[model samples]
Target: MTSLETLLRNTQDVKVIDRSIDYNEYIPLDLSAFNPELSKFDIKCAVSFEEFIEKHLTLNDAKVAFGGYNEQRNLYQRSTVFKDEKTEERNIHIGLDLWIKARTPVLSALDGKVHSFNFNAGFGDYGPTIILEHQLENQIFYTLYGHLSLDSLKDLEIGTVFKKGEQFATLGNAAVNGDYSPHLHFQIIKNIAEKFGDYPGVCSKKELPFYLENCPDPNLLLKITA
Candidate 1:
């Protein structure tokens, strides 16, 4: 039997973004600078999410920005979802964010069936989200695609199957995708428990250990080199 990590590490040619983005067009984005505890990237200074992403794309000289697994970010400060009293301030991003233009086609990394999906609306929510259940050898896991266009949810039903590299959704604009720049928040979950269409994509310093264990770095599957 193959381990999930080994299977993901061995997989190839799997891309979640538009297929046109070749290796030369992609780069890693470090958002730790936005963490007040880390650097001095003041969110107030940026006029809007689009502006923030434009600056990033320009600086990196790349068509798409990717990263954020276990990255501490300050952007969550604007939303109460991460600062609710029950948990510590959740600032660490446990998923890989593919920062690109809106309406870009989003593909599934593996053959899977739609486990659940819904529109999670809020200031910094996922908007239209989808989760797929996949099995690699004997290992069963799940993948999550977030910040999607509302149209992506049209006519979707539970148990709908998709092949690897099949287009299932499109990236949404800031207006509908939690009011942020267009990007696909991709995550891998080992155990979803009872959660239905949603799972915690962000966690605090205190809960980092558990999340880190349950959610492996998506790069393991993406195999995207910086």
Candidate 2:
């Protein structure tokens, strides 16, 4: 039997963003200053998340800013969701973030039915989020699309089905999308447990191992070159 990882790796000819955008159009953004060797920038100075993303896109000369899989980032400093007295700081990002303009079409990575969705509104929350359930071969899994426009969730139902590459959601602005840049936070889960419209896209150092196991790298299926 083919393993879930291998199966995802074998999936061909698919995209979560506009099909016309080429790999070259995707810019690898390193928001994390975890690596001392890597050059760092102050994104906090930007007036808004929209300005921050636009500035990076202009600097890189690309339409899309993509990255943040297992990357330790300082971007979570603004939200208490990642840091509270009870738990250690959750600074490691486990999902792929595609930074782009608001209202940019977001497509399904695969054929799946909407399992659950909710407006996770907060300073650093997912905002309008959707989780899709899918079964490949004999295995079951889920894909989450976070930081989506509220309009995307207006008409969606729990069992609504979306074909592969079907545009189901649009990117949300900073006001609604966790007060950050407009980006699609995509994550894959082997088992979602009882979580509904929300899951931990970022984890603390102690929880990293478990999350890493449950939520594999989304690039395994996206094949988006850095």
Candidate 3:
């Protein structure tokens, strides 16, 4: 069987957000701990973070800001979902994030059927999440779309078919999307195990190896090089 990475690399013209916006309009964004600019503002505030994203897009003359796969971010420190007294903090982001305004159309990366859907409501959670199962090159894998609008799941059902690039959801706002800036958290899972609509999008240093192996970089499928 072909490796999932190779299969993804071989795939072409895959876009998971706003099909109307070309790749040229997408700019790489750095929300990682290494970015000094993030410390200047209150990262915990959703409205402030949205303003930061808007400024980033405008400054770069771009429409979309994308990145965060395997990035260690301080932004997660604000949520108990990532840390507590006993467990180490899961600061490393394991998915690609596309920063855009709320209501931006979210597309399916490939032809697949809805495997699960749920409203994972909580601070720093992936509210209104959806997972799709697909068979590619004789391999079964899953793609997770997080932080989606509630209306996106209003009438959605398991086994609903969505073709490549088809609009299946819309980005959710801070109010419904874990109180973070509006963006789509896109991840590719090799083995979903018993996980349903929800999956870990962040991991601690000790858990990195396992999560990294299970969740490959989403850019492999998106092919967003800029």
TM-score of each: 0.92, 0.93, 0.98
lDDT of candidate 3 over 102-189, digit per residue (tens): 9999999999999999999999999999999998888899999999999999999999999999999999999999999999999999
Give candidate 3 misplaced runs (Cα > 4 Å). Answer: none
Taken over the whole model, the C-alpha lDDT of each candidate is: 0.86, 0.87, 0.94
- The residue pairs that clash in candidate 2, if any, are none
* Best lDDT among the predictions, by candidate number: 3
| Shift of residue 51 alpha carbon in model 1, Å | 1.6
Candidate 2 lDDT over 1-226, as tens digits, reads 7778889998887788777788788888777756552334444432455666777789888999999999998778768989999889999999999988889999999999999999999888899999999988988999999999999999799999999999999988877887777889999999999999989999999999999999999999998872
Give lDDT for model 1: 0.86
Q: List the residue pairs that clash in candidate 1.
A: none
Tell me the RMSD of model 1 versus the true structure. Answer: 2.3
lDDT of 2: 0.87
User: Order of candidates by lDDT, top first?
Assistant: 3, 2, 1
